[model samples]
Target: MKRIFEELAFVNVFAPQSVEKTTDKTTAFVDTSGAGEVAFLVSTAALGAGKKVTVTVMGSDQSTGASAKAIGDAVEFSDSVGTDPQTIVVSYQVDPANPRYIGLKFQHDGDAAVLCGVAVAGRSLYLPAANGWTVAK
Candidate 1:
């Protein structure tokens, strides 16, 4: 016999899983003394083939003091990073036009698995985030 609430209980009608960004107290401000790259891990629940994930780096202009950064382009998610434990490391392309911002994109285009683990790093030119992810110089 079919249960009354069994169907509803198994149903997962929600948005795609995502990583939660917390405030970095130690390296929250961008300075010359200690300013570098930032790493972020995307949740496995939302990691899949053909899935689109955008990573944005936030920073401020020293001269103008205005907000600035770069955004990653959409790419296919693949398992080329690893086999059983697939993970790819894509560096953010920074240029003179987009100064102080390092944007990276990793796509899983091979196997369809939950990508839960992520390891990201910041470059020397990269700046720290005010209320987002950042790394120490």
Candidate 2:
């Protein structure tokens, strides 16, 4: 029998780009301060849509709470799982200015965290940064 392994998924948000002063070619990570969405690349072999993904965000400040609106605006893959040859990506509206730590929890079926993944605190989301908040996932 083949052993199944837990995986670390990479989550990123593609901030909009601007027209270069010298060139017209577009770019990635340009002007990240503007409005955008938080996105993640998931492994279909591991998870799928409507799979009850729990996203958690944390930061360094006590006054700041995870942006619920941001997570709510996320868009899920339609036919991504087991279909798209490329990595599955999901997007959620979020504020770039805020320090953010995001975690996405999917149904693990029966995979034990000790065996395949690291254990995450249920509510210990925020962390201390220089002086700001960030995604804790």
Worst 10 residues of 2 by lDDT: 21-30
Cα deviation of 89, candidate 1, in Å: 1.2
Compared with the true structure, model 2 gives a TM-score of 0.27
TM-score for candidate 1: 0.32
Q: Pick the candidate with the highest TM-score.
A: 1
Q: Estimate TM-scores for all models.
A: 0.32, 0.27
> What would you estimate as the lDDT of candidate 1?
0.36
Q: What is each predicted model's overall lDDT from 0 to 1?
A: 0.36, 0.30
Q: Give the residue spans of candidate 1 off by over 4 A.
A: 1-72, 80-83, 103-115, 122-137
19-113: candidate 2 lDDT, tens digit per residue:
12122111112121222444444432333332322323332222223332223333333333522222444443445554444444322221212
User: 22-134, model 1: which lDDT tens digit per residue?
Assistant: 21111121222222334443334433334443333444444232444435444434433242443334443334444442323233332343424444443345354775675
Top candidate when judged by lDDT against the true structure: 1
